[model samples]
Target: MAPEPTSPVAGEQQDRSGETQDPATYEITKPLDEESPLLSPTRDEEQEGLIEDGSVHHDRDETSETKPLWYMILLTISIGGLQLAWAVELSNGSPYLLSLGLSKSLMALVWIAGPLTGTIVQPYVGILSDNCRSSWGKRTPFMIAGSAATIISLLALAWVREIVGGFLGLCGVDRESEGVKVTIIVVAVLFVYVLDVAINTVQAGIRAFILDCCPSHQQEAANSMASRVLGVGNIIGYVAGNIDLPKHLWFFGNTQFKVLCVIASLALGSTVALSIGTVRERDASLEGPPPKGRGGLIAFFKQVFKSIRRLPPQTRKVCEVQFFAWVGFFPQLFYSSSYIGDIYVQPFLEANPNMTPEEIDKLYEKATRVGTFALLIYAITSLATNVFLPFLIAPSYDSPANASLRAQRGQHTRLSRFLDHLVIPWLTLRRAWLIAHLIFATCMFSTLFVRSVGGATALIGIVGVSWALTLWAPFAIISAEISKLEEVRRLRASSPDDNNNNNTTDQAGIVLGIHNMSVSSPQIFATVGSSIIFKFLQKPRGTPGDHSIAVVLAAGGLSTLVAAFLTSRIQDEVEIPEGVVVEEGLAAFGVLSS
Candidate 1:
C-alpha cells in the first residue's frame, strides 16, 4: 500500500520521474470551498481529474468497497436534477402543445424529433465520450455542452414565435401572414429537435459516467440509487408542472410556457451546480499513458457493430428486456395526460354545452392539472419503492447456509401461494422481473377501467414498482456480465501460455450506447403506433382529447407480459436464489424417479 501524503499544504506526491502519484495512491482530491479552490475542486475541476480509460479500478482493492455517502448524494442530486428538468417537459409538454393551438397530427409531427434524437444522438455521444482524451475529461465536456444547448433550446421553445418574427422581418416576410406562423412552427420544431439531441447527449454521458466511475459489485446499488433519484427528480418536476402558471408572470414572461421554463431553468441549473461541486471527473492521460484510440464519427458505427458481435447472449438480453419493457411503457407514458384529460373533457363539454372557446381552454387546463397530479402520484410511488426496495430484496435466511430467506408476510404467505407464479423476487433477474412485469401488466390492464382521477392515480402509482425495476434491473444484469468478462480478460492477461494476438477491449461507453438504443427504439415505435391509434379513437378537435384511452393502454399491458416471458428465457448470471421464502418452492419428489 502507498503511504499517505505527508504534507498539510497543497503538495502532491511525486515518483522518480517527478510526476504526481497514480490513482493507486489517491482516487481523487477535491477543493472544499470557494476560498480555497485547491482544497475544493469545482464540478469542472472534478471532471478535469477523471482517470483515463483502459485500466479498470477494482473496488475491492480500494480502502472502501463503495464511494463515500457524500459522493452518492452529489451523484443523486446532479442526475436527479437532470431527470427533473427533463421530466417537466415530458410530463407537461403535450398539454402545452395542445394549448399552442396545434392539432393531434401537428403534435405528432413535432414529436418525430424525440425518437430520432434518442436513436441518433445518444449512441454517437457515447462513442465520442469513450474515445475522447480531452483534458477536461471525456464525459463532462459533453454533459456541459449538452446542458448549455438544452437550456438554450428550451428558452427558444418558450419564445420561438417572437424570435422567428425578427428573422422573418429581416427576410422581408410579412409578420401577419399564415406563412410567418408556419415558419415559426417550423423553427419551434427545429428547436425541439435540438432540445431532444441536447438532452440525449447529457443522458448518454451521465449513464456512461456512472458505469465508468463505479466498480462491478456496486453497479446494481448505484443504478438503484440513480432510479431513486430519478423518481425524486420526476416528482419535483411534476410538482412544478402541476402549478397553474398564469399566462403572465410580470417579472418573467407573458406566457405560461415561458414562465415555467424559466422556473425549470433555475431548478435544473442549481442542481447541476451542486453536482459539479461534489462529483469527480476522470482524465486518464495525466499519467502520460500510451496514446489512446481515435475513431471520430466512423468509430461510433464500428463500435456498434463490434458490440453486437462481441457481447454475450446473456448481456444482449438487457436490450431485449429494455426493448419490450419500454414498448409497453411508452404508450402509457406518452398518452397518460391526454387519456386522463379526455375523461374531464367529455364531462365539461356536456355540462356547458354552450361554453365559449375561452371557457373550453380553462376546462382543458384543469384536465391537464389533473393529469399532472396523477403524474406526481406516479413519481411519489416510484420514489417510495426506490427508497425501500433494497431492504425488501435483502435476503433473510433462517441460517447462514439456508437456501431461501424467510418469506415476509406479503411476499411468501397466502399471497405468494396465489400469485407466486408471477410475483416478487425469489432470486436474480429472472424471478424479480417476472414479478415486476406481472404487477405492471396488472396496473396497465386496470387503466382500461379507470374512469376518474383517483382511480388513474392509484393505478399509475402502483406501476412504479415495475418502473423502478425497468430503471435498474437490466443495467444490473448487464454490469454483472461485464464484470465477468473483465475477469476473463484479467485471467488471459495473467496466463503466460494463453498467448492470443488480440484481447477483448471493454469499452463500457460503447456497450451502454447500444443498450440505450434498445430503450429509444421502443419509444419510436410506440409514438408512431399511438399516433395512428389515437387518430381513429379520438373525438374530433374542440371536444376534449380522447376518452376511450383504455384500449391504447391495454396494448402496453400485454407487451409487459411478453417482456416477462422474454425474461424467463434469459440465463441467470448470478445465483438463482439465496433463500426460498416459501417451502413449496422446493418440491420434493417420491423416490428416485421423482
Candidate 2:
C-alpha cells in the first residue's frame, strides 16, 4: 500500500544490518506507558545536534532537509557584520553630519537616503537575486559585490573631508574656502547614499539566502541565531563607538570617526568573506534567467505588483506591523545617541555659563561618547535576551500535539513547565510581539521624563528587550508562513490528480523585499516628518531648555502604541495538514524537541 524508500535521504546511512536508518528515528520496544528515554530525545542532545551538527534528517527534498548547525551558523553570521556597520552609522552618522556643518533638520533630511535606497534597492536586488543564474549562486555574487561596495563607501565617507581638501588643493583652490566645505558635504552625502544602496543589497541577499537554505521546521531557530549574531555585532560596534578610538588606535586614523569606519570595514569584510567562502549556495541557474528586452521588464514589474497584491494574510499582517514598528524604530535608530548626548551636555552648559566655543564642543563630543555607552548597554541587553529568552517561551507555529508530547516525555523544567501550562498558552508569538511594542512605547514616552544621562541610558537599555523581539518575531512568523506555502506547493506537485499548474510558490526574496519595503517606506515619511519636527522644535545651538529630541521620541512612542494594537489583531495560529508535525518543540521560541 506504501511506496518503499528508494535511495537514502540526506542523513540516512546503511547500518551494520545493511538497511538504511533515519538518523532522527530510534527503535522503541517498550510500551508507551513505560518510562523510556526512547519516548523523546533529550533537549540538550537535540540542541547539541542543532548547534554542533548532531545527526538529524528531514525529507529528501532539499528545501525540507535540516542543515548542520555549523552550516546554519555560517549562513547567518555575516548579518552580524551588516548589523555592526548599521550600528556604527546609527550611533555616529548624525554627529558626523553635524560636524560636516549640517543643521539638525538637514541631518534628518540626509537620513532620507537610507529609506530611499532601501525602498528601491532592496526590492530590485531581491528580484535580481531571485532570478540570477550566476555560477557563484544567486545570493553569493550579490553578497560579495555589495560587501565590496559597502567597504569602499564606508572608507569614502570617513575621509570625505580629506578627500575633498586634497582634490581642491590639486585644483588650486583654497582648502578652507566655502566652496571646499560645500564640496565636502556634498561628497559625504553621496557616499552615505552609496553605502545605503550597498548595505540594502547585501541585506536582501543574505535574508533570501537564509530562507532558501533553511527548511520550514528550522526557520525560527535560524532567525533566532541570526538575531543573536546581530546583537553581538551591535555590541561590538557600540563598544567601538563609545571608546575614544583615536586615542587607543591611532594607526587606524587620527579621528574617532575615521577609526570607527576602518573597524566597521574590517568587520564587514571578514564576516562576508567567511560566510561566502564556507557556505555552498545552491545554483539558481535551474530556476531560469530573467526576461530580456522592454517587454520582459514590463512583465517583471507586473509580476512584482501581482505578488504584492496576492500576499498571504499572515505576511500582510507582518508587513502592517513592520510599517508602524519601523516608524517608531527610526527615531531611536537615528537619534537615541544624539538625544542622550544632548541630555548629558545640558548640565555642563548650565554649569559653565561662559564656556568657550571650543570647550563646549569638546564637552558635547564627550557627551556623545557617553551616549554611545548607553547604546552599548542596549546592545548587551538585546544579546542576552536573544540568547536566553527562547528557552523560556514556546516558538511560533508549534502544534498542541508537540507540546503534549514534550510534557509526556518530561522535557520541560519547572519554570518552563509553569510557563507552558499557565503563561505561554496565552503568550503566543503575536501577543509577545504586542507586549514588545507596548514596552517600546513605554520606554519612548519615558524619554520625556528623563533629565539625567543615567536615566536616558537606563531607558535605552530597557528598549533593548523590545528590540530583540522585534528582530526575531516578525521574521520568524513570516518565514514560517513562507515555509507553509512551500509545503503546499510540494504537496500539490506530488498529487497525481492535481492539475493546478498556476500555483507557483512565492519566492522568499520577493516576499522579504515586500517586507523590507513596508519597513522602509514608512521611514521615508518618518524622516520627512522628523525633519519638519526638528525644523519647528529644534532650538539654536545654545538654547538652554530645548526638548526637540524628546518631542520626536514621544511622537515615535505614539506610533509604537498603534503598532501594539495592530500586533494584537494578527492571527497567531494557522491550521496545517492533519498529522503534519514539527519535530522541534515550542514553535515560536525554537525550543529543542523533547
Q: What is candidate 1's TM-score against the reference?
A: 0.77
TM-scores vs. true structure, each candidate: 0.77, 0.83
Write candidate 2's Cα lDDT for 1-594 as tens digits: 111112111244344467765433422111111111101111111111221211122223444445566877898999999998898799999988887888899999999999998887887788788668776677888898999999999999999998999988998999989999999999999999999999998899889877766766677778888999999999999999888899899999998889998999998989988988877666555433444434455765776677777676678888998999899899888899989988987877778768877886788788779989999999999999888776555545454555466677776676554444433445566777798899999999988898998899999999999999999888988986676554444333343443433444556778788899899999998899899999999976645677898889888988988889889889865543223233221222121213
The number of clashing residue pairs in each candidate reads 20, 8
Question: Where in model 1 is the C-alpha error above 4 Å?
Answer: 1-64, 169-176, 246-250, 287-299, 395-430, 483-501, 575-594
Q: Tens digit of lDDT per residue, candidate 1, span 1-594?
A: 111112111223344355684222332222111111001111111112121233333222331234555666676565786786577577767777776567665676577677777877887887777667766556777777877787788888888878989888999999878898777777777888888898888787777766655544455666777888888888877776677566435477776567767776776667766665556555533423322456576766665776666665556776887788887787777667766777757777777678887888888778877887888888888888767665445321112222122232122455434333332345554566678889989988887777787787788778777777777678767764454343333333333433333444345666677788888888777777767776787665556435546777887788788888888888654321322211111111000111
The top-ranked prediction according to lDDT is: 2
**Quick one: how many clashes does candidate 1 have?**
20
Question: What shift in Å separates residue 195 of candidate 1 from its native position after superposition?
Answer: 0.8
Compute the lDDT for candidate 2: 0.75
Please list the Cα RMSD from the true structure of every candidate, rounded to 1 decimal place: 11.8, 7.8
